[model samples]
Target: MVAFLDEGGMVDFTIEYELTPDEVGRALHRGLKLQLRAVRLAVPTILAVSGITCLLVDAIGLGVGMLAGAVLFPFVLAWSARRLAKRQLTYLCVPTTLRFTDDGYEYRTDQSATTMRWPLFGRVVSTPEFWLLFVGKQCSAFLPRRAFTSEQQAELDGFFAARQKAGAL
Candidate 1:
């Protein structure tokens, strides 16, 4: 057994689980969707409109390129983001255990262990399936939601909400 306590003397959430390639892929896909939502929408809109403008002006070469970019950029980006999951998940050669508390989080695997403070993370974003911890604009860690029981999920939600309210996150 292990005890994880905050300064307020509350025990936090503990999670242990292995991530399948598919889950990793889905999480990565969702993370990218979150990060790129505006870009994805705006880029294609601009490209398509520009493509139409160029075509109307009889700039065939530029129009084709713009049209192609409009059609291909988002698809290629989405595909690359999905493929990135397979490569990134290879580091988890074994299941991992994670403990969350007000101070920070501790991560442990068969070969490695580390702890990081919550402030080191710029934001925490939860998808339907996972929690993504972002450092800068990149996602540095993902915790599978399935690892948490309903009570633990509530604990985690409260933890982050409190942190956000405190302006610590």
Candidate 2:
């Protein structure tokens, strides 16, 4: 179980979990959706255009193939992303702990620790299963919803909302 503490003027929490390949895959997919909206849309649009162009050129089989490929693009993309995420996870499968505080957040593993100020996070994205903190165009960390109790989740949500309102995110 995770723990939340209030000390001085700061509210903090500590989370420890073994990083899993499936989790990594989900994170990658979420990051892609959040950061590459145009690219995602363009791939299908380009494929559809190729399909139409092939039909105009009287290449029935090629047009059908392009159309079919467009239809299957999402599945193919997800499969490839999962494969890539799994490969990347091989080096990241470590027991990790994250500490969230009013000033910033800290990430720790057996070998090293790193901290970043709250302003460094560019955005906060909440999915049903995880809250992804993005730094620049990539996700820096993801906190699973299951790690927090309902009350704690509410507190965390409120904290983020307040930060967003202040233009801190």
Best by TM-score: 1
Clash list (residue pairs), candidate 1: none
Q: Flag regions of model 2 displaced more than 4 Å.
A: 1-9, 59-62
Can you write out model 2's per-residue Cα lDDT over 1-169, one digit (the tens) per residue?
5666666645688877776777777877887777777767888889889999999999989999999988898888778778878787855568878788888878888877889888988888888778888888887777777667787688788888889789898
Global lDDT of each model?
0.81, 0.80
Task: Candidate 2: count the clashes.
Answer: 0
Worst 10 residues of 2 by lDDT: 1-10
Total backbone collisions for each predicted model: 0, 0
Q: Per the 3 Å backbone cut-off, how many clashing residue pairs does candidate 1 have?
A: 0
TM-score of each: 0.86, 0.82
